[model samples]
Target chain A: MIPYAELLGLSVEPGETAPTYVMPFAVDVIGRPGFLHGGAIGGLLEMAAVGALKQALADEGAVRIKPINLTVDYMRGGRDKPTRARGTVTRLGTRVANVEAVAWQDEPDRPIAAARMNYLIVR
Target chain B: MSDSETPAGRAFDPRRLFGGRFGGHGGRLGIVYHDHGEDWAELALPYHPDLIGDPASGVLASGPILALMDMATSVGVWLKLDAFKGHATLDLRIDYLRPARPGRTVIGRGECYRITRSIAFVRGQAHDGDPNDPLAHVAGTFMAVEGYW
Candidate 1:
């Protein structure tokens, strides 16, 4: 688990390819009444993206990562329920990595939020 | 701040809305309502050790800043509409111009430029101290849960 991921109380679920991140519903993560904060959801997506990128580069040498920018789209208000997120690396170049992550509550098919992130990778 | 919710025609006082121990994420991070105007709102996030992303650098994480801007912009939408209506973030994009200065309060100011029937457009910037030198730039949209009447 990443440092920020642990702060958000996120845990990695066992998976073959890309690990899924689970964030349980709690006061520390809620936004308005009975809903999750957009920031928390965004953070979760980012952590998922980072997790995927790390896994993709696990075989390679150590690299430092920094975020360039992020765009988060909230499709639905996250209700009082555990949310799950997973990321996909669209492009992995020498200097940068483009990742996209989706977060869902009840069903994977129905995503509550999605985010696109660009990261600077330093070798 | 008054305990009552602002009347429909009056300006919204975010301080009152956020008064007392915040129960959720906003409370956990100690997000406070700073100031506002007819179409804009500002919120503050005080630096804390737990909010740091890189302890070595002592710079705050981007997640807390994102949350601050999210709430600030949401309030801006409400202030523009002149009424509290149910809405959700449609999309938000943040460009990290620079990391916020450690141990300094970061203030996020959000403005609502336009509002259609269902969509509100917002833009904002975050800065530690100097507004001219902003730490982050954000642009986003919010959609009403129910049709705007």
Candidate 2:
């Protein structure tokens, strides 16, 4: 189990194509008064991105991945609800991988937050 | 969350806001108040195994650092406003310069450079031991729910 995910009470549900990361609204994730913390949302998105990267690298036996950078855009304030995130690997190269993730509370079309990330992969 | 609290012109104390043992995620991650000024604030994130992103390296995850910086910059905005106006993070971008060394505390400092009627712009950096050698650089904005003075 990922320590940070466990800490946030984040769960991963395996889907047919990719895994979806879910973060429940709890006292540990509150930012202002009732909304979710941006960093918590960012963490869930990062976990989703990493999950997608791992799925993309299933063929490789053992590989290490390190995060290089991330840009998160908060479109809407996260209300007191379960937020779900999914990552899509845009470009997976030999040494670098680019991933994008979106997080939504109710509707998939209406994303509350989105992020693009770059990771360094050591084969 | 308005200019009401600014009536007395008392400064917003982030340390007081983060009082007690539990402050949600910030407290759970052991983020403590380090220092603050008029428009800048610094926070400390102690090393803990629970925050390790890579178990083999035992290095802290980028997420926790992001959280620290977020709170730091949020405090910076409040400090700059000199009031506790409610605000939400609009956007944030982080560049990881290097992974933090294992078993080391990280210090994150944030500064609010600009504040408009409804938005605040901030930038910050995180360092493990030395302020000169930073591990992460961050830039972001916050949207004041109430008008910012």
Candidate 3:
């Protein structure tokens, strides 16, 4: 696990193929008195995006992944609960990859936040 | 000294607000105040091994930087309004120009450019050392629960 992710108490749950990242609601991830910080959710989304990209690029050998940019939309206030996030690799090219991730607490259909990320592949 | 000399100082004191508590996530990240203006605020993130994203490169993760900018912009909104308005980040976009050098503190400066009745527009950049060469650029908006007025 990335040290920052570890510090945030983010863990991975194995899926059939890829993995879903989960962040526990804790003091380290809190922003306001009652709500989760925007950054923590953003971080979880980034981790999920990276995890999916890595899984997709597993056969490519030691290719390094670099983030180009990310846009995050906060749809709802994340309450005190374990938040889950998963990523979809929208496009994987020779030079770049696009990934999208969403975080939700109760229902996957209703997300608390969503992120679109682009990464540069260093081969 | 005078009224004009200290408008936000009277209401939204970032120093006193964040003071020793640091408040959860920011506290865990070891972020500290750097400076501020009437409509802008700067915060610094100290280097720590625990925050590294890429262990091979020892570079700090972008997550912490995003968090720093979020808080900085949040403070910028309060500074501009001269009070701490209840608001939440609606959306934020971050463009990574380059990775920060290992073992250096990162400085994020956020500015609130406009404030309407319900939204505050913000933009900022993060730099490890030279302000001219920024590591990331960010723009976003916050939705206020109460009218910003």
Candidate 4:
């Protein structure tokens, strides 16, 4: 888990390609009675995206990461259950990286939310 | 909502709901209601060590700022609609203009620009001390599940 990820109570679930990040339903993550807060889901997606990006760039040596921007789309209201998220590096360049991530509960294919992020990679 | 639903039936007071207190993610991030108006709301994020992203830089993470704007905009929608109906964020976009300075409280202000029967359009800005030099800018939409009456 990343340093900031711990503040959000996020954990990693090992997978074949990239690990899935899990955020349990708790008071810190809830909004609107039983629904998950949009920001929490957004944070989870970011952690997952960064985790995946780090793995993808492991062979490239040390690099400093800075978030350029983020866009999130909420499809379904996340219920009172643990949410899982994973990211895919859409494009990894020398100076920048584009990543897409999805968060879901129950299944991976049916995502509750999705996020697209651009990060500046300083080497 | 039924056409018969009156404004009095759904009247909302953001001040009462947020009044210097925060629960859920807002509380976790130490966000507090800063100020509000007829169609806008402001939230404050105090500096904390745990909220730091890059240890060497001592700057706060973008996630907390995003949360602040999200809640602020949600409140703005309520203020604009003049009601507390069930609405979900359909989409939100944030552009980081610069990193926030450490130990300074970041203030996020959200404004509801327009509204329809099903959606509310919003835009906002976040700044540490100076509004002219903002740290981030945001635009988003919220869908009313109960339908904006």
Candidate 5:
């Protein structure tokens, strides 16, 4: 299995309401001139959402889950700097769980991106 | 356009750009350059069967297309900005028009509609054929950085 650090290049942090993940934006992740590549942001969001789901499962005394699909909406241009993402579990059913997350740089009010993802929970 | 002119004014050759080996998904998916005077750009794809997903069904795989659109839109911005440093994607919304045709190559062409000091906006489409009816449509925004790359 690929280490989480290698997969996402970030460490996962646990919290009460949600879990947070931090990723540093660098020149390698840049796309055009001054913008962060959309794919990189998508990867970051996916990792954060998945990490949150994993943590939530552990909290509920459950095990075995995998990502099924993820859909992201871009709200604003992401700046070239470190980014923080927080994920919340909106719903947790027996077979499936729904998650929502928002990623931002310095401004929380103005999010760089938002995403809703679904995971399949195994028994 | 003359033989001495840059290749931008001429039609794009996909084989030359996407052909040969690549390091990984990131390298293959990275957007290199667009045909200078044209709307199309060269996007690479690392060798990964997972990216092909359903081979029998011939789906071009959403993950790679997502990467392709991301790169295409960024190049669209670079075309307009002339000289850009770094930018972040503010938003990227893609509407899958249909299942991509299988066994054939995929190409993306994007156009920058507007830009400002802080943000650059773009819209583009991806297709295997017939640009008029694309396999996917994407609209996104990128934030400009303070320096150049």
Candidate 6:
């Protein structure tokens, strides 16, 4: 299996309740001017959700989970600065898990994007 | 751009291409055939300030690029197959090599890599400079819809 960091191009860091992922916004990632592209943010959120699920399953002694569906809501435009993402496991059933994530810039109160993803565990 | 050029190549008037509403954004996001013939078709998008996410910072909106690429690839299939067969994108993946520089119009040239009865495979790149090392690369598959449009 590939290391989570290598697969997502970001690393999971310790947070208060759950872990946070840092995705640096490079100039190449920009969509229009100062705002990051929707596609790029979507990709980032997808990766973060998947990584969070992997970590959560590992804690429970599970091996693998495959992504089934993902839905992202663009709350506000993401600035060009490096952004941070946080993911939480809402529920981990026997064969499925529901996860939620939020991405923000400097302020945690205002999230640029939020997502809810469903994963199918491979037992 | 100018209001000239048709799909049939007779006087090439833009009004006649795709029933004169080709450039409007209501349906299919204003994709129109700039040039279409036996081998290839070209599509164009007008520059919009809203599409410009950063004025001081030079970059074209990524949504517009994706829309352009999606439409271009579909149009390529239509031209090659000689009909408007519907298709759904399976997975559209893009790698951003560089930011699209501001103040320049962007165009996508998509080619059908392979097409079967059920699927059409496509690979193309978006460029603002040197097409060899493009600013963006895209690879995707479109499942052919059964009904014709």
Better of 3 and 5 by DockQ: 3
Candidate 2, residues A34-76, lDDT tens digits: the string is 8888888899999999999999998898999989999999999
Looking at model 6, residue B135 earns an lDDT score of: 62
- Which DockQ value does candidate 4 get? 0.66
Error of 6 at B109 (Å): 1.0
DockQ of each: 0.65, 0.79, 0.93, 0.66, 0.17, 0.05
lDDT of 4 by residue, B63-132 (tens): 8899999999999998888878889999999998899999999999999999999999999999999999
Q: Best TM-score goes to which candidate?
A: 3
For model 2, what is the error of residue B50's alpha carbon versus the real structure, in angstroms, after optimal superposition? 1.5
* Cα lDDT of model 6 by residue, A1-123, tens digit: 222233224556775556777767655455445666555566566656765776776666746665554555666777757778877889989898998888888898898877777777878
Candidate with top DockQ is 3
Residue A37 in candidate 4 has what lDDT?
A: 87
lDDT of 1 by residue, B45-105 (tens): 9888777777778887788899999999999988888778888889999999988988999
Q: After superposing candidate 3, which stretches have Cα over 4 Å from the reference?
A: B1-10
TM-score for chain B considered on its own, for each of the candidates? 0.90, 0.91, 0.92, 0.90, 0.72, 0.72
The TM-score ranking, best first, is 3, 2, 4, 1, 5, 6
**Candidate 5 on B1-149: residue-level lDDT in tens?**
11234355444333243344222334534333334333334443333444443455535446466667776667667656554346666667676676666654567666777888788777877776576878778787777667323
> In model 5, how large is the Cα lDDT of residue A74?
76
Model 6 stretches astray by more than 4 angstroms? A1-123, B1-31, B37-39, B129-133, B147-149
Per-residue C-alpha lDDT of model 3 across residues A1-123, encoded as one tens digit per residue? 679989889889977546799999999989989899999899999999999999999888999999999999999999989999999999999999999999999999999999999999999
- Report model 6's interface C-alpha RMSD after superposition on the true interface residues: 13.2
Q: After superposition, how far is residue B4 of candidate 4 from its true place, in Å?
A: 32
What is residue A44's positional error in candidate 3, in angstroms?
A: 0.3
Model 5 ranges with Cα > 4 A deviation = A1-8, A59-62, B1-42, B48-65, B72-149
lDDT-based ranking, best first?
Answer: 3, 2, 4, 1, 5, 6
lDDT of 4 by residue, A1-123 (tens): 234577888889876656799999999888788988898899899888888888888877888888889999999999989999999999999899999999999888899999999999999
| Local accuracy of candidate 3 as per-residue lDDT tens digits, B21-128 | 487999899988888888998899989999999998999999999999999999999988888878999999999999989999999999999999999999999999
lDDT score of residue B90 within candidate 4 = 97
For candidate 4 chain A, which ten residues in a row score worst on lDDT?
Answer: A1-10
Residue pairs in steric clash, candidate 6? A33-B53, A33-B54, B5-B12, B5-B14, B6-B12
Candidate with the greatest lDDT versus the true structure = 3
